[model samples]
Target: MNAKKLQKKIFPLPKQVEVKDGALKLDKVALKITADVHTAKQAAAVLEKKLAALGIGVCDCAKTTITLALGEAPAQVQFAEQGYRIAVTADGVELTGFGAQGVYYAAVSFVQMLDREIPCCEILDWPDMDFRGHVIESRLGSDLMEKEDWFAMID
Candidate 1:
């Protein structure tokens, strides 16, 4: 597929992307956390749950493994505090993040990319702004929002 077509599969649009010639099959996969990457386990847990809900089994014997790690971007690539890079290939996927938040974001994107088909690509992305928030005015009956409602909104 073309670059634009592959990019359309992702939300918020990554800053840099290079589409490749093949796709990765995620029918069954494993989550691998690199050494010293503390936050990656939590992010992988979230990813595991998300994948399970979609009928994707997580097992140690799976051939396709999603590896998460905390590392520096290549010298040519510049990433903000919450930046991440995702490299998807036929063999597996590598998610490298700058921080804990970046790891979470990378997992989020990976989940999104799992819809339909996952093309082989490299994505380098970072938020344009430091803070993202949502405001609920009291006038709009925000007081009536329940705990479950808030959790759903956050999810």
Candidate 2:
């Protein structure tokens, strides 16, 4: 699919995105991945393993043209948790986040992008909040709790 069509496939849509003209064909690119922190490094390793399954290997030599950086996002970028940015250019892919968790999410987004065959695109995204909560109601609560329980708890 073309990059434009694949953009919508990403979850929690990126704040900004740009689809470029050229695609990063895995078969034609020499991909290299590196990270500045341990967490990001581990994430890169995970990506390495996944790509290996597809017969793509990571390189550290000078010939490496497509570099994937799993690292902390610059301080200016605001997403604190589970927020990330991914940019895919003709020459390389750069993934950044506020911290380790963000870095992981960045990788996740990248993988999602790849899954959709979206080869050339740029994305800027971040979560609005760090915590999420959900509530559920059930009639079984009445059977499980006694009046004494409610009075004792109230005390």
Candidate 3:
């Protein structure tokens, strides 16, 4: 969907709409959505769509990064069969990391969070630290919260 169309869908009430000129900025440097051995093609597909929706794209489909074994890590610590770590920097957003569990969790978080309809635009973001980031999914499905109400009506 286009950004204008998306904005309308997300914030429907006409009165509540507000426009800002600089709200959408494209980074001079390309956005890098990298993943560490992002093995699952299905999961990767979802991530690709989500990033595009967020107005971010891969500068180079091949970027080197890291991966962590979920089973090897303790429960108290964030773990994944694989991991999914995404970051935003001054230049653009980065898919900094991912693995088994991480990929699954990142899919859920991103589908829910990233704007799924940003038109050709730019963004400025940065990683808090060159460290670890994690996302967790208790249940897996297309049950995004915002769509629950819409789903109920359809059902």
Candidate 4:
């Protein structure tokens, strides 16, 4: 595992053989991403597919639409971003914003973390850098780059 990169971190996800939600019994596994549009929807879709592959039912995502922020490199990372956050949760997890990406990576990481028949664990993590950028700050607005004007240039 790469110590500096988050994907290296491994943790276990609880295997709930039975789940009872209030008066209803649901073997269904629940999840929600409290984040903005594009990323949130994409993340929710990806998670649902992965869970189905594992034979686990995906519950539901919190909401559909997300509001764009003022100006914080307001775009989703295509190949995923590297950070210091990714943790296991009790039920599942509630991840939001750029921080939520970390959770997505962690869920995948948790799958790899399990030993033979091992189950039930939790983790708490967060990234140090708040801003995630795909382009170099210097090349942002120039004719060479031609990126959006709202993009921020961190010094």
Counting clashing residue pairs in each candidate, in order, gives 0, 0, 18, 2
lDDT of 2 by residue, 33-117 (tens): 5646666766666666666667665565523244445456555566565667787765567777666677777777776666313
lDDT of each: 0.79, 0.63, 0.37, 0.37
- Candidate 1: where is the Cα deviation over 4 Å? 35-38, 74-79, 135-155
For model 2, which pairs clash?
none
**Per-residue lDDT for 1-155 in model 1, tens only?**
77787667678787888989899877899889883665677788888888888888899999998998877755554445578999999999998887777887888887777743578989888877788565673336436877787777769
For each candidate, give its TM-score against the true structure: 0.76, 0.65, 0.33, 0.38
Model 3 poorest 10 in a row by lDDT: 11-20
Model with the higher lDDT, candidate 1 or 4:
1
| Candidate 3: Cα lDDT at 108 | 44
- The per-residue C-alpha lDDT of model 1 at residue 6 equals 61
Candidate 1 at 20: error in angstroms? 0.2
66-101, model 4: which lDDT tens digit per residue? 121111222333322422123223333333233445
In model 2, the Cα lDDT at residue 148 comes to: 78
Model 2 clash tally? Answer: 0
lDDT of 3 at 34: 35
lDDT of 1 at 151: 77
